[model samples]
Target chain A: MDAPTEHLPNVAEALARAVDTRASRERDLLGELEALGAERERLRVAILSLEAQRAALDPIEAEVRAELTSLDDGAHEVLFNSLIAQRAAVAARAELVAEAARAQRDAARETTDNIDALLVEYRQFRDVIEPTLPDLPATYRSVLKAHHDGVVSRLRQFFSRVGADPVPLDAPALDLDVVIGVDGDGAEAVGVTIAIPVSGDVRAATLEGAPELELTLAARVVQAIYEGLDAIGQPTAVTAFGDHRGLLVVEVEVEPTDRADLVDQLLGIMEDVLGTSAELLAAGVRVRALEVPADHLFPPEESSDTLEDAS
Target chain B: MSEVAPEELIVVPLAVAAERLQIDPFEFMRLLVMMGEVPATLQISEALIDRVRAAAGIELWWAEDVLLPTDASPSRAIVRAALRQLLERGFVGARATRIDNLWRGRPEDEALLRRAVSLLHREGMVGMSRSRAGVVVSVSPAAVPQLDAAVRGESMPAALAALA
Candidate 1:
């Protein structure tokens, strides 16, 4: 006889609970996929309707053109002169028809493009979720930890590549502090602060003489970093400090839990961001001695001590 | 019947009058004789003559002459005839005066000097000094070089004759 449900081991109950949760999520995703399919069909019909509307104007336009040409050729000048008012009316109507046709064609093209993008997105979502949905609830904790680790690793790689020292992060336990919820509600966040020493040339100039040039360079650097983070679906807050003792500090704080796989994508995004810096460096704005601050390296309780020790 | 006082009659210095007409004082007196209008000559006050002479920077004291008496003044018809003769023979135009100096001209010559002053004032070449003696005038300092250039050579003689 099968074991009684009440007497089943706690581990077995947990396994069963995970399986049920996965099944429920899979069902929800399938429903969403079905809705998306319907939406795609509706879009396809909308595009066809617009195309047909555009085609319908073509015959009327052609008829107007024929009449205009007949008037131009002077095949029936007496009749044409008699219908001069009608000819003008027809010309105006033709122009309006042509305009409507162009508008319709443009609408149809735009709708088709939007539908294509939706389809691509739906397919990608389907591919990702189909194989993983069953195992997601089971590996949820480990996955979250892996994601965090991956983000930190990518950040370290980014710092190393950019000649910056990574500030050691002493974040709380991943399970307790960083929650990667199913509905994308979580506190999984990472903050990276890098100090880029202002080059001798940039530091030599007074801010009063060429303010915009210096500020714009600093702004561009920050914008490049922000763009990189945004592209990877990592919501980031960026702050850039003016040269303090010849150091230009940029702080980037990212919420990795906002999207899945964002941590894995961070390195590539940061590389792109660093590409702009590389260009800036090539243009004679050298940024060196890139490092994270002691405060960022230690927990709040130990941060002061760490800083003092470093000093 | 009317009686005229000598002081009431307009008397001018001969040196100033000759300078106004741009002719030598003795030459002008000779011209008056040739016109059959020989003027009665009278000496101007020494102080007045010296003041005008010094102001005008005229060192040729011998060039100074007696004023032609108004009682024996030449008629306009005779003066006009003399001017025509002078122009036919050619004469220099009037010289510009200093600011502190007074103008002296015979009745017929007064109109010509007045017109010359008006032209200089209109051309912004002279500044006017209002006085009971009449509107005393002088060439502007800036216009001195221009006046000098205008008077160079025999150019003034022809220009003055044209004015006549």
Candidate 2:
């Protein structure tokens, strides 16, 4: 072995041999891989054939499913139509009942409204004729209407004396709405009772008058009545005594309260309107302060007092 | 320190010299004896004060500049420089003296005194004295502390006392 010459064919020759070995192994691996690839191709083709068979049966399967679905749809449509017809029948019956209820309600409302209208008419009728009814028999509806008229007349006379303008009787004045019972017992004597509103001041001015002036005003009242009756053509025959004058000796009737009001009305009329003063010139004017026999001529009717009382 | 005769020794108190020169006593002594206001001994008395006062009235003398004592060396230049600085700063003033031995080589030292007077005026420490002399100056009740403060550049221990 005499040392193989020439450096054993250089490093390139050694590297080329190793590459050729790797290339041979790679070619053998390529051959085996080509065989495996051929087998895979066959298997893939078989799977493709099976997939084609499954695809070929898809339409028949879908047709059968569709036939079943149509059967179900036919049954459901029958049931749904039957239910819709039943619901419409029930709703129509309920609507008829509701319409009947609405008609009944409308009739009830109309009946209530007609009753209210009749009540209003009756009230209006009552109001119109109530005042005249008091002059009728005791069986008349109520006595308030006739008594109200008398009070209203007195209030008018009071205002005229006090320099207040006469207003309509229906004006809203707070007054006692009196109710006077008619006797109707055929003596033809009509008795009156004043209602006298609650806590009203009928004698307030008298309470404020001095005792002497109160007596003096009473005397003046008697004189004025005598003079007023005489001036109105009801010639009053007055009889005089010691410090006394009698307007009426017999059949003279007047409440002290009423006489006071009458006196105030007369004096107010004289002083406020005519500026003429009237005085008593005496002490207390007692109804029985002086005695008189029944021989005097009495005042006839149509005197202002009689006329005012009649009204 | 020779034992010279008393009259020749000029034994006037330093305070009298200060009054004559119208300066602070200590400062006048510092300018006269210690600093050598003269090259030779000189007499000092009330006559010297009269001389100085007459010179002050005539406007012929101001005492602060010439009265400073100095060394025997010939360094008159240094003394002159210090005097010039003092004059510029208003610490000294010049005064005229007799050229003979009676008042020779003594500089008037009225700077501190003039300043003290001005300070008194500023502090309202000088008041008018109604004497025969017209508008004479007398010490006001404030003189003690104010003058002391002006001299010492510090407030005095006691304030001005009320006059009896």
Candidate 3:
């Protein structure tokens, strides 16, 4: 079990390297501890000095009372009265200093507590972000875009199935507008807007004493659209507008980007709406088309016929 | 001593009932005449009947044939005609011979009449009473005195005037 002489230098080198690394870390830790200890000691000394000064006020007030009792002549009494006033001022100032010191100590303790809590939170945040940090920017953007696209595609599918024919074949039948932005944490944020064009027969009934059938039909169509959107399980903010003619404009906004299968889910919703539409038509609600406007796919600023402004 | 229960009755005004049936008061009186087993009648003064015969230059035996002042009032005339017909038909009784200002019809027609009377009551044109027997329809007590005064050929009473 004699020492392997050939491996001695390598062992020694390894030992020296471990010692050097340990020593460097120890020095850094010791430096930080020393700085913290110095700060604590300085605060302790300050508080102690204030306490001593406050304690001295009692003895000083006793001496003032002794001096007041010794005063016999009127002039001496006046001077002793002035001395008492000065003593009272000093006592008041000492009380103020003690209060300030106590406040500082409490603040320091609160700061220390906050720092401990913040350190835990910071570690958790780092753990969460560390693995994704390298590819976060690109991945975030792509995910945001995919979510926006999914919503738009689902909405388009929904409109295609529900909307009447003469559906614009080459262009987007409905407007699917998305706004993408970077958040404070560099995560991509997205907003989606879909505009659906609603058209129906606005012709006034020629029969005398007939009710306002067009307006009634428009209201029914808008209600059906709202119900259909709700049934589809998509969180959309819907707004409806009537042009006073036969056209109703419905704008739906999908703000949340969490659902990945938004389009497919909406197509499933259309199946339910088709049954509802058949019943509605039988009830004399004659809405011909509830399609998305072809031009709405482009940015709202570029489109001349923005349903948002029309509403 | 036994405690007597308060009488509850459903009464509709004749005018109100006529309006509900979409008919004139005279036409309503005729329908009542047709429906009743015993027709309503009013007593005529023999002196008045005789005076009408003399004015018409009719023989004393033909006094009954002469048109009486009852002819001027369709309400009074219909009651007389119905009573005469009932007498000729051999229905003899004081109740059968007398006509009431209020008209009541067959029991089978009660439901239809009650609905019509209820409509008039809802309109505040008549008062009603309901009993175990059935509904009793009549003009409001406030208007009864006025109707009596009209039947007597006198000015409406002060109490009824105040109501008006």
DockQ of 1: 0.00
Each candidate: RMSD: 52.8, 64.9, 45.8
| Interface RMSD over true interface Cα atoms for each candidate | 52.3, 68.0, 32.7
lDDT of 1 at A143: 66
Stretches of candidate 1 exceeding 4 Å from the true structure: A1-187, A199-207, A210-217, A234-246, A256-267, A273-311, B1-164
lDDT of 2 by residue, A1-311 (tens): 69766755667888998899999999999998998999999999999999999998999899999787644324323432433343233233323433443455355455344433433443343467665666677745445445544443433332223211111222221211111121223233222111111111111222333122222222222333334323332322221211101111112223222333333443443233112212111111111111111111111222232211110
Over 4 Å off in model 2, which ranges? A1-5, A10-30, A64-311, B1-164
Question: Ten consecutive residues with minimal summed lDDT in candidate 2 chain A?
Answer: A241-250
The model with the greater TM-score, 2 or 3, is 3
The TM-score of candidate 2's chain A against the true chain A comes to: 0.19
Model 3 Cα lDDT, one tens digit per residue, A151-183:
434333332332221111222121211111111
lDDT string for model 2 (B1-164, tens) is 12332122222333345444444322222223212232111224433444443432312222456443343322332222222322333322122121111122233323333333344445665443211111134344445444434333243212221110
lDDT leader: 1
Writing each residue's lDDT as its tens digit, candidate 3 over B71-102 gives: 45443433333323333333332112111112
By summed lDDT, the worst window of 10 consecutive residues in model 2 chain B runs over B95-104
Q: What TM value does model 3 have? A: 0.19
C-alpha lDDT of residue A280 in model 3? 27
